[model samples]
Target: MIRVLEPPRLAAHRREPLLNVPPVITVLAAAMLLIQLVRDWVDVETGIEILALFAFIPARYDPSVLADGVLPGGVAADAWTFITYAFLHGGWAHVGLNLLWMLAFGTPVARRFGVLRFLSFFAFTAAAGAGLHLVTHEGELVPMIGASAAVSGFMAAALRFMFADGGRAWRPGVAEQAVHAPAPPLMDVMRDRRVIGFVVVWFVINLAFGLGEPAGLVDGSIAWQAHMGGFLAGLLAFPLFDPIRRRPGSDSYSRTSRF
Candidate 1:
């Protein structure tokens, strides 16, 4: 009897879910959305009051303003507004744009940094943004609100490792590995042509926003300074937050290794 040879069946293809966002990202997004909803539900006066209480107003630190007690929340507001302002936004448009960028850049960061590190990084960047805003717009009464600065920071942090190890090309099913891959030293990253190009483009866009807003070419004033501060902080402080330790005499850092 002759037995016929048959081809082996192929394994079923596993599909990745469309929305593979980390839980921390989801929770942060929800919190911002909920805050915006409450702000919208309140009356105009209450909404303004909310901004006064939570938004980062440069004038809050002004000696005269502090003495007058014009702003609510007092000393507590002085302390909390650095991060609380990130949760507030001008409107749905502002918050929606922020959420979009946050998801795009924050996913990889959250995945790599884990929960606590990511949260601390977020607060650090937000505070840095607020600090810079105060410096640039000192004693200004305008309240700065939005998550753009922190989102910008996430974008900067992601850049540290996104292009490492031939990751410049996008390949399906390997995104997880790409983000978790070891990052090059900051000096090497600065020298990389790809990284340099992205930085130039990002700064150009911010410059355009800064110029256009004053010319009435843009609708709302963009807090580009705050964005710059957060981005710079993230780019420089990445090593501190990175769990991956670099092997001595090696160009790359690894998560499995010890310092």
Candidate 2:
């Protein structure tokens, strides 16, 4: 197993907290939910749909707020819609869910890949997701929004972080090792296989959801294409985003004496 140098010292300075730091995903999700609850109160004074839906990713719905559109099926003429559309969402639940996923997995991936790179990849995936949606939907105001595309990319990166062979493991030292105990199976699933499982389930479930030719839950606006594209982006581009720090043969770094 990997060795811990000291009680306080860490291996490297990745510049951010760990993925589950402060359980950020949970906090963000909660905050979004709270904001949604307060929307009605704010609407009276603001007089605008504060958190209403806006199709912002593949194409920017003309109205900046929700409940205001009978949009065209094609792409937005302006290129910036690719960026703006990501901010819009169908509902509070959508925003909360997507952000929660991002925080849950996005933070750690950000740690490995630099923050800027993570943001870039995230945007690229969002755009790519939209492009995929456009290809599949073809000429209809599908009205898409949410950070699912970027989140998918993050999920892919996280899976690789977890499962790819030949990498560093923050192993415990003799003392910590002496007191150590293995975690339960469920925890192991959470620590390791969660990403892989998520990827598989996400792909299959979404694909199945889209099986009726956009007639099921997706309802003629399934962005399975975007999900796939974003996933592929995360799967393939992780190394480029965060070049793996090789230290001799990663295979041998762990202590082999332990049984």
User: Candidate 2: where is the Cα deviation over 4 Å?
Assistant: 1-77, 165-198, 210-222, 243-259
C-alpha lDDT score of every prediction, in listed order: 0.79, 0.51
How many collisions between residues are there in candidate 1? 0
The segments of candidate 1 whose C-alpha lies over 4 angstroms from its true place after superposition are: 1-18, 65-68, 166-170, 214-219, 250-259
lDDT of 2 by residue, 1-259 (tens): 0000032454232222432343434554465466546643464534133312324332233343323343332333335445445554445556666776787667666545544566677778777777776665554344555567777887776666443322222222221221122212222334555445666798887687545343322213445566777777777765565534334544322221211
Q: What pairs collide in candidate 1?
A: none
Task: Encode model 1's per-residue lDDT on 97-171: one tens digit a residue.
Answer: 889999888988888888888998999999898899889989888888888889889989988888665446234
* Best candidate, TM-score: 1
C-alpha RMSD by candidate, in order: 11.3, 11.9
Instruction: Estimate candidate 1's alpha-carbon lDDT, on a 0 to 1 scale.
Output: 0.79
